[model samples]
Structure formats: structure tokens, C-alpha cells
Target: MAKLWILLLLVCVFAGAQPPERSKAPKVWDEKALAEWATPIAGLNVRPSHIRPKEYYDLPVVSLRTYPVYAPGREPAGYWQRIQSTGPKPLMEKKGSRTATEWIEAGKIAFEEADFFHLRTLDPKYIAEVRNGSLAPSRVLPDGTLFGLRWVPTKQGVALSSSNCSFCHTLYLPDGARVPGAPFRTIAPRPPETFKVWPVFSRLQVELGVLVGSPPFLMPGLSVGARLSQGYGVPWKSDDPHERLKTVTQEEYEQLDLAARSSGGLPRWNGSIIFPAKTPDLIGIQERRYIDHTATHLHRNAGDLMRYAALVTSAEATRFGPHEMGGPDTKRIRARFSDDDLYALARYLYSLTPPANPNPFNESAAAGQRLFQREGCVNCHTPPLYTNNRLTLASGFAVPANAPASLEILPVSVGTDPSLALSTRKGTGYYKIPSLKGVWYRGRYLHDGSLASLEEMFDPSRLQDSHSPGGWRPLGTKTRAVKGHEFGLGLTPAERSQLIAFLRTL
Candidate 1:
């Protein structure tokens, strides 16, 4: 009878060890259903102002071959030759399997391999500079992995490549394991050495644009630069060199300088703003109804993600201008890919799964979970998904009357820095309640990448006037308090540590 009881106990333990059943929720976006739902919302005289143009919907049946064009009247630079010879090729061919899975596989290849931004043109120069010690190697994380940029091999030679979505969303751990769809924390520090490469590269780009003999209207940077200069009150074509100096105050000039420096050595066509947003994780993105920190892009369906990818990679400057101004460029770029390709890309992105948590639940973590619930953190970051997916208004941004009523636009402010939401083109007067599911891998918390770690977030020192400078705070702003998201501030140190541990397990 004792032996029989032991066997039954073992069976019960085995049953308890089995993983819980996952919810059978639909992962893919249903465009028709979304449209049907939106129809009634639209009839109420509230419409989403940022809808993609009709040309986006009418994509080509197959991928088209596209090449980078240089500035007119300039000879082909050595950089152009290196890029043409060694740059990574597009994954989408003229002919391939049209199945959804195959397309997703193709998209995965593209995500890992494609240089959609044409950043690889400077690869040869960058390699030579690093090898010759003219440029310092990018800082490696504690895990011995360089996060910002990596090189991949091509047919001709090695290609210095920037990330696609995979670079931003993937995390490499100390154990030499990679977690796809995790928020990448180990961004390379912006060394001053990297700035030297830009002037040379920009000159080469202009020369190439001239040599390619593209019409002035077709020149890549000209119109965008002009538009940006006008918007920022800089005179790109000013006869007087000191025209900007006369109009702008010293403080305003300094602010502009600070903003420009915030781009971190990237070639930014648009003038920078006070605070740029952190890259969001793609894990469980299908469950997210809104896109971006500002909730500027409404993610009603997979096509919306596709549209977003297309716009960001190519014509992001278009967002600042009227639709008519950027219509031609948008249409031309949209024509390169088919509806199926976009759908497949979205599918591949949605398919990303967060890595398994190596940390097991313990007494401390269990206590922390209780604290998480007790402190009202669950109110905004609700569970199952860990985000209510609602839009909370920033302090200064006023919601327009024409704004869609379907969105959950809340009135309360979280008291975090509102500069990005109030100032940038991506601003829609709202910030999305981000999910906390994979908080273990994410760093530099908050919308603007202000707080470096969960501990710093809970640190009461952040409320003090002499708060230490870190994250993206400029040198002058060091003593400025990092305010807002005061949920865990009142917790005891032990409780805070427990709360952090519990957050890591999520």
C-alpha cells in the first residue's frame, strides 16, 4: 500500500510539471475584419489622419531590382565601387516560391542580411579605418558582443552592415546565447572618433548623386535637406553665412547643436529633437494595437507594420511634409515589393518568440510578484500581455478633434520627459503603455532611454535635484532630476530588490 501511494505521488508531480496550455489566440492580422470594425468608427466622423496612401495597397506582384543613385556631375567614387562589388544582395529574387511560409523564410533572410538603407557603401572605408587604427573599434558589451554594427560576408568581400529589425530586437547574453525579439541593451557608445567619417562620406554621396546624372528632383538628399532646413529655420541656400546666427539666440543655437549631436553620427536628413525614443522589442508585437512610443502609427493589421517598415527605411522625411510633397517618392518605393512580401515580412516579425527565462521563481521573486500587484504597476502594465495598450497623453500635447475615437486616448500624464512626444514629427500627443513581458533583457527604461536599469528606475535619488547624469542626458542636464514613473519609489530596499527580481522573471 505504501509503494502504491509513492507511485501515485510521482504521477501527480509529473502532471504538475507539465507546462500550462497557451491561449489559442489568432496571431495574424485580419485586414478585412479590421476594416469592417473601423468603418463604423470612421462613420462617427473620427478618422486616423496618418493612413498610408492608396499606392501602398497597390504593390507590385513581384519584387523589383533597385540600385542606389549618386549625385549628378560627380565621378564614381571608390566607395561606390566597393559597395557595388561587396555589398549584400537583396533576398527577394524575380522568381521564388509564393507560399506564405516561404515568403516568411525569405523575410527572415532579408532581416538578417539586407542593407535596405544602403549604409554598406562606407563598409570598405570603415574597415580600413578600424584596421589602420584611424577609427576605434566599437565598444563591446560585458558579454563580449558588439551590439550596434556587425560585419557579414558577401560574394565579393565582407560587408560592414547596420542592423535590420533583428539588430535592434535581438539580445546576446553572457552565456553566448542569443534571444531573438528581446530588447537589445548593449548599444555602442557614441565615440567622437566616428564623427570624422561623416564629412568624407557625405561629400562622396553628393558626388555620386551628381555623377549618376539623376534629375535635381530625383536627387536623394537635396529636397529633404531643403525641407529640413526650412523647418528648422536654417538657411541651406542662404547667401549670408551668418544669417542663422543673426536670427537664432545663443541658447537656441546651443539647443540646435545638442539636438544634431543626438543623432549619434548617423546621417540624419531631418534636424534632431531633444530626446529620441528607444527601439521597442518585437516580441508579442501581434498583441500590440499601437506602434511607437508616441502611438503615432496605429497597428490595425500586418500591412500597417509593412507600411511602417517601408516609410522608416526610405522616406521617413515624408512624415514631416505634406502627403502630396512625398507622394511620388513614397509611391516609387512602395512599388518595389508585393503585398505578399509585406505580409510575409509582417508574419516573420510576428513569429518572433522571447527566450526562456533562465531564472526560476524563488521566495524573493514570489514576494516581488506580490509587490508588483500591490504597488498598482499592474494597472497600466496589465498582465497576460503586460500592457493595457492604451495611449496616455503627454503633458503638453493636445489631442486633435479629428483623432480617431477607436483608440484608447487617456488624459493622464505619466510625468516622464515629454520632449519627444511634444517636439518630434512622430509625436501624436500620446505615449503607448509599453509591454513588460521581456523586461529581463531590456535596458534604459522609459520612452526616452532615460533610466539605465530597473534599480535606477526605482532609485529615490532620481527625484533629487542633483540626480547624477546618465543615459541620454546631455552634460549640461546632469543635475536635472529624472522624474516620473514613481511606482516603486516608496518600497523598502529589500522590497525593491524583490520587485526587480520579479520584473526580471517576466
Candidate 2:
């Protein structure tokens, strides 16, 4: 027995003596891959600007998950929910809408059912079972939604519409257009996709279907539509995944992608929304200075939430009331909603949070930070929250031109009253500044996503007279370029590289 024990011990000792193998830790970006990404966009100041002192915005912070999947109190709701909870108070009511208790009581009814997770699974039978004015929680069109694309439910008809919104607005890639004097054109191997964790380059292209290849402005999904149709319009011809991205003319591309601009000669297209953009991700939306493409401001408050819901979901187009965009189908939906239901949605929207992760504290990125301040990118995108949260005509884009001349007559932002502007082509002067929190996760960067990658944003060649055909293409493009954040016009390639490294750490 002693001899057998000795032999076993010797075997164990020999096994332990074998060298321990080292395991590789997962990297967000492989060093080489990150370098490649930064190479083309060299010299842009991507580091967070430190010129301003960090003044924390006291926005509400809430947990994102809820029990029973989407229960109101257990898991905090997102901005979409909070925006809808304002209920049916008149936008100009002196006394405001309802008591806190009253809202919650009614909100519970709305909250119980007016959730996407819940609605996505509802049986058609359940939808049919609800009687008008039922007031019962489960029976109250529990699956009602403003539109699949919106972050929070709104009274706007387009907000409730599906696929169309997502296709036009979210996940956009730049058309590769350039600013008046930029030096580089935005270039990328693929189209934009939502950013998750990374090995980034290859993984983004292969698995998540980040867009790859030409007509840089085209969204990958839309490219898919074009390839399938073989030059036809949306509702593409085929479902074959491989055959969906053939090159086509810009007009042809838009034809397949955008809703018709002028259907049978009316002012609007058959399927277009006033704002055809996709509802952005809400993970860090509380930090944005602005809310809509029009730059409609929504501070993190209950009153703004109420107005958003009532204006977007309510059936009537009464000045401040909801505007239905879904034809006859929407009229039926609006009839079913009440003020209390709106409150639930508002409650949900105000409760959003950025996705969780510890700050990377990348040392290499520190060099980039210095560059950011040196380059003056800090004026608009001030940090740690990363925005001044102020509105300016800079984002007005073409909206002012397209609007009636009366809008031009109004004093720019502060001088004009919002109420009057609400009724006219132009009214409000305030354009909310968006927060830069979580900018890394979004692609088709910028409010319009005109640029394909960050690289195109900084190239000086993009700013030349030959580049931008119609002034600066802020969203970015292929032919012209999206100028960099105007930081580091004098940066050397090596320093620019370090700066990009720091940006990735954010």
C-alpha cells in the first residue's frame, strides 16, 4: 500500500511540473485592427476635450431591466416610457395634467400592456377582444405602439409605423460627401452597424452584418433591397442574402430606399414621415442636447414627456395634438388611447441608462485627450458628459430652407416663441445639443449619418472647393467628405494615431 501511494504521488508531481499554459484575454479591438481603423482618419482629434470643467448634468438615472420582463416599478423604464407618461394634460394647462397618484394609478393600466416586449407577443385575438373605452388593463389594446422605430411611443402616426422608419434613419452610413475644404473622403470596408463589443473589424463585417463595400452612402439593408430588386424599388425582388448589394445610381438608390418624395403630385411622398429618420438607441440618450432631427428639445422632465406622447399618438392634428401617419389604421389606434395611457409611456422613457462598462482608462488615449483640447473640438462637444446641450442653427441643415419663409422671419432661437413656432413653419429657436455618451456604439455617425467612418471626417481634402458640392456634408459622403471635428489641423500622423487610440477607450 505504501509503495502504491508513493507511485501515485510521483505521478501527481510530474503532472504539476508540466508548464502552465497561458490563455489569451479577449480584446475589444485587436491592436493591429484598431491601428488600421485610425490610419485613414488620421489627425482628427477624437479625444474628449478637457478644456471645460466637468459639470455633471443632474439627469435622472434609472435601472433598465424590469420584472415580469417589463413591469413598471421593478425594472425602471426607458426614455420611451417616461416620455409617454405625461398623460392628457393640455400642453398649455396652467394647473398641469394630473395628480402623481392619479397618473400612477392610470399609468399602471397603460404600463401593464403598452410595452413592446408584451405587445410583440400578443395574439390577434387579444387585440380584437378589447372594446372601445374598456378601461381594463389587459383589454386596452395592451399591445398598442406608436411605431416600431421610435424609442418612446409618440402620437405622431409615423412613430408607430414599422420597418420604414428603421430603414431610413438608424444605422445610416455616409454617402461619402465632403465638407467644403476637407482633404479626405470617408472610406470603410463596410456599411455601418450597431457597435457592440469588438474584435471589431472582421467580426463587425461577418457576423453582425456591418455594411461592407461601395456607394458608401447606402445602408447595407437598403443595399440588400437594391440587389434583390435588380433596379426596382423597395419591397425588393429577392430574399437571397448574397445578391443584395449591387452598385446603382444615386437616384435609383434613393428610389429603392426612401419613400416617394412626391406621390402623384402632392406635397409629400406616399410613405414618408415628416422626419423619416430612425429612432436612435436610448442607452445614453438622456445626455443628448437635442431629441429630434428637427432638434426639438426635450429636457428630462415630466412635462416634456407628456407633450411628446400627446403630440405623437393622439389622433387629432389639433395644433398641439397627435398627428396620425398610418392612414386609416392609425385613426383606430388613436381612438383607443386615453391620457392615462400616455402617462405610462412618459414614465418609461425618462428611465433610460447607458449600457454598463467600466471606463477603459487607456493611457495611450491620454495623448489623444490632449489633442482634443488643443484642437478646439471641445467648444461644442464638451466633456465628461460630452455636450454643451445647447441648440444652434448649425444643425438646422435644410429644414429652414424647405420650411416657409415665415420661419426665416422668426428670430433665430431665443427670440422667437416656441408656441408660435409650433403652429408655423418656423417657431422655436432652441436646438438641443446632444450628449456624446456612447457615441462609439452608434454608426452612420452624426444626426444624418452622412459619413461612412470617422476617417472621412478629418481629411483636409474633403474641405476643398472641388470636394463639397453643396457646402459641408456633415453626415459625410463618398465623393466629398465629412471634415474632421476641426481639431488637429496640424497633427502629425503618429500623434493622430495616439489620439484615435484614446477615443476608442471612451
Best by lDDT: 1
Q: Mind giving the per-residue lDDT tens digits that candidate 2 earns over 460-494?
A: 55455456422213122325444333455457777
Displacement of residue 161 (Cα, Å) in model 2 is 10
Q: List per-candidate RMSD values in Å.
A: 10.0, 22.1
What ranges in model 2 sit over 4 Å off?
1-278, 287-289, 298-300, 315-333, 336-341, 357-359, 395-432, 461-478, 483-485, 488-490
Worst 10 residues of 2 by lDDT: 262-271
Top-TM-score structure, candidate number? 1
Give the Cα-based TM-score of candidate 2 against the true structure. 0.41
Clashes of each: 11, 83
Weakest ten-residue segment in model 1 by summed lDDT: 209-218
